[model samples]
Target: MSNSPTPSLVKNGKEDFHHVEGLTSPNSHINVGDDYANNVNAKIRNPLLGISKPDLLAQVTAFCKEHDLEDKTSVFRKGSLLAQHPESFEDIEELDEEDKITIREEKTHKWRLPWALYYTVAICSLGSAIQGWDNTGANGANLSFPKEFGIENNTWLVGFVNAAPGISGLMSTWVADPMNNWVGRRGVIFITGLFVIFPVLGQAFTHNWWSLLICRLLMGFGMGIKTTTIPIMTSEIVPAAIRGGLVMSFQLFVAFGILVGFCSNLVFYRIGPLAWRFQLAAAFAPAVPIVILIWFCPESPRWLLKKHRYKDSFRSFCRLRNSEVIAARDLYYAHCQFVEEEEAFKGTTLAQRAKEIFTIPRIRRANLGGAIVMVAQQFSGINIMSFYSSTIFKEAGSNTLETLLASFGFGLVNFIFAFPAIWTIDTFGRRNLLLFTFPNMAWCLVAAGCCFLIPAENSARLPLIAFFVYLFTALYSPGIGPVPNVYASECFPLSHREIGVAFSIFINNTLSSILGLTFPSILSGMGPTGAFGFYAGLNMVAFVIIFFFLPETKQRTLEELDYIFGVPTRRHAAYQTRTWLPWFIKRYILFQSNARLEPLYHLEGLSGGTTVEVMAIH
Candidate 1:
């Protein structure tokens, strides 16, 4: 008579019933005082008394189907599911290829790369392009801007112009976490767009050196915010299967922006007095679209869940995933992850959460890892070439035209090589890519330095130096270029990710400032050979540090990293880095074959303790 569905009555004591969570109707059986005693006497002592396990499971399965509760792992933890349904495994093993395919199709959703996702990701990644443009665009302007500003000979003035935005970026980066917390990721980006636009416009019009410097500093404020938030937002929005590539796509756009800026410089170069101003203003092109596109996309679903806006989170998740079932499943796990994180930081305030970054060993390690990648990215000398390619080329005995052409070549090579990274990052993986490319970067830098050591008049001198520079971009773009952003974003907990990334950016810009501000002086003093040799040593050092410390993060969920880093369980120093590549490749193949490769950790029976049994779906 009650609204809830009642368990079917046994026919001749053969049919069975199970007390399955979310399946059993609460109103089916209830009593008060003497009524309870009467009901207990009327029925068997155990609620499941006389019920067989197999029949009970059958009833529960029917109930699950009726209720649309498709998540089998929720009803039965993965280990328990397999253990209780032993016949299922036997059936699985005995199935023909066609039947196996049918079963796989029934169990897993087919993954299609959605257009909306790519559009959204590409739109968000424009921030990186803007970064590339703003940073390297100045390199072309530097040749002429110094003359217009009447600060051509002042090394300090040159350094200040180059470093001004970074200095502002470093100072403003501390606010990134707090602002991101206050405003959503989308809001922060929109704000960043404003900062990016107006200052760049100001740089285009400003006559006085002081006004240009002010514009550069203001631009940093926006850069700090954009650099920290975009990668985190990108990671959170996309599924783990393509997270590496999508996030790296942000870096890819950075390469595109660099190339675009280089082209812009060439077009504006012959235009005389206004060439430098137009170059400074060219940064506005990327920012305008970012501001427009962000409004059309959804805010981060994870951030929505954190804010307890479940309805909004679900809506956002649905838009991103383009599936109600997948969105619901993702939301369910996100809820669990959020609850766990909340309990961990239950009594702590924001300040306390900030302090725990250092106090907590796992978080501290994550922060350290993030720091290493950010610092290594800067020290690898990518930016030295990016921010001061003109200076380097000029020092290599190139005339003005040759120097401009060389800068354009550097940007083009950087842009072209970034495409390979999109595939290799998800396929070959983050740590392995770093290992493969950084040594090559070092070698190229060494070779570049050797070319500079040749006589200034030799025809081989500039060409060989340019070749090595191009080679460095080729090696660096596919490996180190994108890995740092992907690696740093992966290293922190969702709660800490904003601050973690902000801290990493702060360190990154600080180093950028120091290097960009000081590189000319370094080139002047050490000459091109010595300057590049110094970079070569640093790249080699980066290789060794990454080899020892960075772990393989391919194919794992953002939440899985918490455990991956916690106990040194699977992806630790104990396992050789080389072994991970083969293991990941095999897993990837199984995934593509629709094998439904669940993580063994999801089977709690293996460990026999309370653990986060997150099933990593392909």
Candidate 2:
């Protein structure tokens, strides 16, 4: 593909510059005059675009001096030029052999990153495991804990005990904005780690239901902070091209923790009443490594940049990226994007950013989209399996041993299936994966519900129910499982990221709390058949909402998404219904090879106003 810009004059009296075709080159530049720039639809121009080589070099020199990076001015100049015209790197004759080789490797060997980046992501991912283990620990404990506390017969109290963490989590998420601002990402994570460790360990020694509830609720505070910060931390450090895969590590490790939790449940099941204690206490294991090693990892460079610690931000970037040139390019590019973000937001206070999350058109759209996915995740019924699978299996006619084994199978399937999303999330895209999986999951739920009617005497009844439930989990792990955190983390700009993510997670945990508190009653009143069928319908509802509201965000830089979300929600919805849906039928269902789908948002560059139809293809 050619990287050089081609000038195309549009009828609207604007100069347009077309780069390459397709979604791969969606970052094309557009040159417009001052009047057009002030319009609501005006594109955010790249700061370095349309500059002469000498002026670009001078800017890099000044940037280096201002940031106390004068020692790397030569590196900064080339890196800045490459960031200005990313697609046309080869055309820049100023780039040396080493720079060209490193840039090429970025594409060819995208996963060959520095050890420090991998270490940070790995440690952060441990937080997800802590969450997962905490969830499934309760799953196994649900069988024994209630009876021990004499609340087994009281479904409401039983549910309340189970949901205490989620209730506390909902309240804790509101503090995320200020906490992240005051303490930074690493500080919040470390403090939350203490909450996960001690409170979870306290679960093993609880003599009464209320005491256990207090411990779990205390743990939720940590859960809320860690969950809110981890995705944002991972997203800011990774490259945009592979960001979905990396951030989804949060989900992948959660799956692993769930699997381990099940293993703990089974191993301790032989110990009788005390097995529940060990299962609950085992969650603290994952948190230990996170709290211990977090200080060794570099803090988020974007957070540093937000604080105007340019030198520290640059140093942090150096540890996360493979080469100085790559780090310099990312740092400078992020700085440029932040400049635009600050001008647009104009409020440094937590209250102002929180307000912007709801009021600003672009931020509001992102909030809505992120909120939909997070809510959908809970409504998908996966958590029912995660938090109560043992109870569910027992209800389906399994003995205590059989129930533990079945729940273990569910955990294993969840963990194993999550592996595919590591590759498919970025390649197949988030919206496409969700759209494909929801209908399948709905039918699996219906199938599982139907299996309940198979008479208790039948030998195949339990296995059939297990099969369908596992099938539902298989569809979930690759689709809704990983997509929500990845999507919510990347949708908002840096200014509102902490608040925006906290809000989304707040929705997630609140719904989770409701689900945990109500599912036992729901199962009792509606029976497994009715309850499963009801959530199945909700799956379809989630699918429809996602189709209309969620825009495709794969491979787009965090800054580029401003334009994507800036397109009105109504326009996006209308295009999906009136345009893309018909095109999908024609192209795939009707077998029309020539069918073409128009892109919804046109990417405007720095210099001129060019119309580029970036096809929303997987």
Candidate 3:
């Protein structure tokens, strides 16, 4: 046997071997005759014929020149064009003061990249806490201020209280995206931090609602940008293995902020008239430390990379990863892969990309399910408890202290529960959890809503049902809260993940805004029972949809997620049957540890055509 006869057998090779994309041995049977060209297009279009392996490239080039296309220059990229690599990382370097910094950032970072990214995760959580605080605290203050300000029926103030941050956030998010592009993530935050004080001081220094509302809106907008940006930067800076867990810190902080706000309200409720203003002003307190500390924080390498300042991007990546050269390489390659994908589809509009997401069956299914999950969490009547828990408890017969204590309890529940979701999300898997108890959550809501329907004289059961609502809140902290963000964050092509999160969160907040705006009015028109029952029905529908449609995405890498969702057929087909997920494993997991290795590729039966046949060995 001529040891290597032409067209050696990969599809039906000597051995029926299956391997990942970057690592599979190049097909040895390719003919070196004047039959193909050696160029980028040729290589990409016909990678199956072995354009990558060095042994084949020279032979392929001879054939290419014979066909008049070989002399073209080729940019060598030792990685796939997807958002991640099978066995690679980003390029990073350590600083001169390496010993002190490396000991701190490398052995362990104080906060994970996501939590550390923008002080605003802490700030936004606090802002949201303040929203809850003001909503809750303002009620407590009114007990004293009702006689002080000589006003009654403070319900309209509720909408202003909640809507203020949201309205400002909407504007700030739009501006934040642009500013980060203009200056840097750090600079935009620093400058935005400056504006933060103007509102805090305005609220503390001034005495009117108009002044307060103006400051709240401005603070809300700034926090909105921070809320959105923190997740984006965290996802970029951290490793995928812990991405969800790290992001949970931001949500966790929000809960803490709420507790802080509530306690501040209670402490000040006993004080002079100036206390409410101080509480509002206290919201700005985080900005001061953020300004002090963030100057030491490095800009997001990914953001810097986006600016086309590669060196800065590289250095930023180095700092975030604790200066581990191995980790640095993985980061570099993954970043390169992401940047390539981003560049490949750079100019698609928000609307157009959003359409592609829901229209493509694979991506659409994931996106729709995630959106429903996010909305369902709200519809489970949790927001009723969250937004109006103090009122609910009071209606159920708690005094002011008891209600504030209840408010504190909800914050405590959120903080406590957020942890398990981070711990178990990747383990339980997204689809599996959603399939199991999500409907149960809806059922619990139904029961709680019905309780509200009973006559107030039947107050005995209201507390029980209200407690059930609190139980629902606890159920939510871990599973529902983190999973939707995790899945939505993972669902789209790497090229569009950021925008996807933006669009989804945008929908989330918009729906929240509408609900926040209307829930009080709805509560006024219909009793609490009727209001939450409607939401319960919505959750029931959401549950049915999730059970049938959502696919599990826990272990999959972002790069594979791109392939798993980008192509209409392959997207769905990824889960339709089983093929070796070596590409996914290689790109996402092993690519870092084994840098010398190549990623695997397979047509996976119809990986080329649309049939379900496999290549068998001789």
The prediction achieving the highest lDDT against the true structure is: 2
- Each model's lDDT comes to 0.71, 0.84, 0.52
Clash numbers, per candidate: 0, 7, 34
lDDT of 1 by residue, 16-92 (tens): 11122234333323221111111211111112222334444454454345434545423322222232232253343
Instruction: Provide the lDDT at 398 for model 3.
Output: 67
User: Residue 534 error for model 1, in Å?
Assistant: 0.4
lDDT of 3 by residue, 32-88 (tens): 321111111111112223333454334333433533323321201111110112211
Is candidate 1 or 3 superior in lDDT? 1
| TM-score, structure 1 vs. true | 0.78
Model 1 residue 315 distance off true place after TM-score fit, in angstroms: 1.2
**How many Å off is the CA of 295 in candidate 2?**
1.0
Whose TM-score is higher: candidate 1's or candidate 2's? 2
Please give the lDDT score for candidate 1.
Answer: 0.71
Error of 1 at 488 (Å): 1.4
| TM-score of candidate 2 relative to the true fold | 0.92
Instruction: Give the C-alpha miss distance for residue 8 in model 1, angstroms.
Output: 38
